[model samples]
Target: MKYGYYPGCSLERNASAYHESAMEVAAALNLEFAEVEDWNCCGATEYMAIDMLPAFALISRNLALAAEQMGNGRQQQLVAPCSACFLNLSKTDRYLRDSPELADKVNQALAAGGLHYKPGSLRVRHLLDILVTDVGFNAVAEKVTKPLYNLRLAPYYGCLVVRPVRKTPFDNPEYPTSLDTLMRTLGAKVVDYPLKAQCCGGHMTQIKEHTALEIIRRLLKNAADYQADAIVTLCPMCQLNLDAYQDNVNKHFGTNYNIPILYFTQLVGLAFGISPKKLGFGKEFVDAAPALKKIGAEPPPKAKKPRPSKTALPMPAPAEED
Candidate 1:
């Protein structure tokens, strides 16, 4: 199976591990992902809020590229690993398909860039969707090199992928089952987290620290109640919010929730016997070393700390002298 991959900006930067694991997993699954050429942004949360038409056009422009670059004009698939990107791409296609007025407006914007997107030309899916629905949970189970047996995982859906159901194309609105299925395939017990779809307060963490911490507290609290060893998620944003801010959340809430929030790809890479380095463990703030330790995968080599730049001479322009 061939898919068009959109790594999004974050994956190239903060989520490099996601990109690495995705490649390893794609190889393991025997599915080829040909990245589309020169793809633009998906117009994430910010664009839609600022202006709807151009935002949809930007996302649709990507969809149009995915459609045009399909290996054989077969089923067009865009493997979006980020929930926000997936939601925006999927939402725009769905909305445009149903709303002619909106479609016309978006297409008009596309005209400026000499790009045109036909509604329903392609399908936008989260990485988990492709893993579970396209690849099948059983196939994933068969690839387990080391089962995460007895590891309790809280499958967090975050708000973007499953919420505002009208936009997402995956499973049930209120309850998504992909992550749970993927977890079970890895031989771990999946906990039914009530706060799975609850907002992690996303980028709002910086804008509204207290509220974001509270929201994060709830998710960790529920995961703790279920005694989850780790929180598995599909979005880099959710993982960043929960993992990077875990210390702050615990500090504020007076609770020590030590659960590691891991991208599902990291888990899959582990299960497939890929080295932890390839899975990008060192990049995480809270340190998944101990967590990966529990599963018998050795920790990645400690990344070298950067050396400070040497003192520089003061700027001086030779103007002169005599």
Candidate 2:
């Protein structure tokens, strides 16, 4: 199956391993991905709230690129790895293409850039959608070389993946279980954490540290309470907020709840039988090595303990021989 990919900015830096594991897993599943040429940012959470048109236009710009650049203006559906980008890109494309007033306003802005987005020209899909609907869980199950039989995971939807009433079509806005289903396909024990779709407080980590930390703390505490080995996610912001800021959250709350926040792609990599080393398990700020080991996934076998330096004991032995 071929998918036109729009990786967004996070994939290039903070989430490079996501791209790596995604591509490798896609290859394993025979998924053909063609990335949009010279794509731009999706305007994330902040841009949309402040300036609606330009924000949508920014996301639309990438969608327009996806339609225009992918063979003589032929519309092509884009597969987005980040849930925020997926929702933003999909929402803007859908709303603009549907509402004439909005489209005219956006097109007026587009006049300067020589870009116009035609409605229904693009289909924005999240990585999870592609994994289940396109690739099929059974196919994913077939590729499992090492099933994660014992590990329990808390599926964190964050805020962006499912909400705002009407955008994505996968599952319930308040509670999403597709990720849990995918994890279960890999033989993981998925938990029913009611806070799955709760906000991780996003960039509020910068502007409102206390709020972000509180939110992050709750998610981690709940996951740990549910006996989760880690948290599985579909957004870079979610992964970054949860993974990178975990220590800070602990400091703020004066609690030590350590749980690895893993990307859905990394789990897919494990299901596709990729080694844990290539999956970037050790690079995570939160130590995932322990949880990974529970899945029988180790970091290159810890390099066999070096043999005792021969010279130390050899000196006395050689003297005796002499």
Candidate 3:
């Protein structure tokens, strides 16, 4: 019931709602999350490409910290709510165990801080993996105060969660059903999403705008084509690309899609009878009020002035100066 929580960069900023809702859900399920002390960034998706040894060393630092926290001898069950964090940590752990040379190099870097990580000493996992495997859907369904009746949701797992099949043996690489099953457990009708495991073009939007839009376009178009009310996601990167750049996708394709990309944990929080305000509901660029109305979930309190049109949402800009 206890886990070492790793709320990566996104959870502290852009995907704060996911972190909020995840903590809310964990509390309701009687799960305890002790955040890893002095955890660092997992180098995200871009850092690895920039430099390999540094990226592995950076990611290893977090794993080393998590293992150190499990002072009582058992392998630490470190869970991350962000997909990028999960992939980086999980991949780092795997690579470290698989390659002794790499493991030695990472350990040497850690020795500078008087820390040395033993590969395979920490059980790195995603929040979704814990919920489905450890918490169980039946237990989740039992706690639902308000089932998501009649809500047709597309469960978008995106690429990172299940890709590189060897990493996530439990999930099908081509089409995973864990998210879809989780939504159904909340009483929402799960749409058959063909692009469920497709890439969200992580960092591609910043690198090649048009190319990223096309990749995002396919996912959005597929969801709309299936008549899904909204897209529920497990990854912050996926959620950001789909939700924040939605307008750009529309502009590129000349399509008017207002699909709300929501964190899967947010819906779980709703079913557990948590308030929208606590779940960070109104923070999304795309308003989810229209879709939530279908399930009778309370909308965010309205502002006196009208909300801006989707086009008026701040465009994706270059990284701002600190």
Best by TM-score: 3
**Descending-lDDT candidate ranking:** 3, 1, 2
Off by over 4 Å in 3: 164-168, 296-322
Candidates in descending TM-score order = 3, 2, 1
lDDT of 1 by residue, 104-181 (tens): 898888888887778877778888888888999889988998887656788998888766544545777678787888
The TM-score values for the models, in the order shown, are 0.86, 0.87, 0.90
The Cα error of candidate 3 at residue 197, in Å, is 0.2
Top candidate (lDDT): 3
Q: State each model's C-alpha RMSD to the native.
A: 17.9, 14.2, 11.8
**lDDT values, one for every candidate:** 0.81, 0.81, 0.87
Worst 10 residues of 2 by lDDT: 313-322
Candidate 2, residues 34-139: lDDT per residue as tens digits? 9999898888888978987789788878877788866545456689998788888878877876699998888787767998778678777888878888888898
Q: What ranges in model 2 sit over 4 Å off?
A: 72-75, 164-168, 296-322
Error of 1 at 223 (Å): 1.1
lDDT by residue for model 3 (168-251), tens: 555787889988888988988888888899989999998999999999999999999989999999888999999999999888
Against the hidden true structure, what lDDT does model 2 obtain?
0.81
Superposed on all Cα atoms, model 2 deviates from the true structure by an RMSD in Å of: 14.2
